[model samples]
Target: MREAAPPKQLAFDLPLDPRYGREDFLVGPANEAAYGLIEAWPRWPDTVCLITGPSGSGKSHLASIWATRSHAWTVPASEVTADSVTHLVSNGALVIEDIDRPEGREEAALFHLLNLARENGSPVLITAAAPVEALGLVTADLRSRLRLAPGATILPPDDALMRAVLVKLFVDRQLVVDLSVVEAIALRIDRSLARARAVVAELDRDALRRGRRITRPLAMSVLADLGVPDDETDEDDAPA
Candidate 1:
């Protein structure tokens, strides 16, 4: 049997936030249309858009992209209220994230903001964890209005996409990782792209702690210690 590679010392510094600009977001079958829509926002500034996906599925990243590229302002769902809608609408191009969390005053404010933006021909983007129809809004008008906004859903990234995401993240952090290590990580971790990111972050932390390189054994040890399994097999393909 081939001996496992020695535990290489990973040169890890303090963690950096993952880069999620247009360059970092991989475009595959899963999110190509959503990416395209974001890219086209400048040309269609009057089009109101709604983007929905699971938590950590890059909703805020997309919003940031629009904010930077189109000079749009972003408001958190919790801070919005009827009183503040007019000020937020003044931004002309706006993004509201976590729409599902706002209730009572905040929800009403969001509805009014949407109406005001529409009337003014200002572009607005709303992000949520679920589709508008599933938001469970108490106000019928709010539900009906949201249902009319053009919307897109970002599907979770698949294995190949996850591997690409990890490679890009490590490279952005200036860490040199072997292809075998990348493949091993992509194959072993949970399917969620977000989870893959967290695992790499943890691995980086472990390497920093030990002042060592990241090798198969080191990764396994760190993941196991964190309660992440080390089965070295893709759960999507394994026999039940």
Candidate 2:
């Protein structure tokens, strides 16, 4: 039997939301350990885990996975309070994202929640842009406690990883993308998974609007419009 052809891409509204999941998140040496930790959450010795990564590194996507898997509740850093912690947790796992931004009161509440979760045997997962040591907290105990939690850092994806991620994004959306087009975008755009995602998303919108496939020409035009310098195009002219 022959393999079936993939489905065609669909036109949809622009996705302002960031994409994250096992399927969309590309694994490379940069993030393999973190990926492993996330996948092995079921076997994690401590219920509490701290995931830290640069912005646009897909922390929220990982949190979504854990939330679904562990029936975890998420409390935005701004909304965290001692009372809210009790209500939000309600015996379920907790995923606290952007912990570094919480105010003093929120910090206090988070500290209390950590202690509560540890005592009750419930798990707590926290994510921040920076490591726990970098987040200056007013409470000594909370800072010390957070420092003790196992930390997972998501390293930035490289050009190859970014290209693969872009290809996957287009594939997921049913968009047709040739390898040349993928390479062009990957080479020219800001070298970050977040930037690659944004570029692909914008190209997807532009392609739908123009009723055209995602070709190198279209990708270049979109990148140019986005103000990304066309240095990659000129690289070929450099003396060997």
Displacement of the residue 78 alpha carbon in candidate 2, Å: 2.3
Q: List the residue pairs that clash in candidate 2.
A: 9-174
Q: List model 2 lDDT by residue over 25-136, tens digit each.
A: 6688767777777888878878688888888787888888777788888777767786687776675788888887745447778877887887778888888989877887
lDDT of 1 by residue, 1-240 (tens): 999755646555655866657777787767777787788876763457888888877788888888888788887887778778888888778888888874543667777887888898889888999988788788888898878777779897887788888888777767787777787777777767678778888877777667676786777777788777776664433689
221 Cα displacement, candidate 2 (Å): 1.7
Off by over 4 Å in 1: 1-15, 43-46, 103-105, 233-240
- Candidate 2 global CA lDDT score: 0.78
RMSD of 1: 5.0
Error of 2 at 67 (Å): 2.0
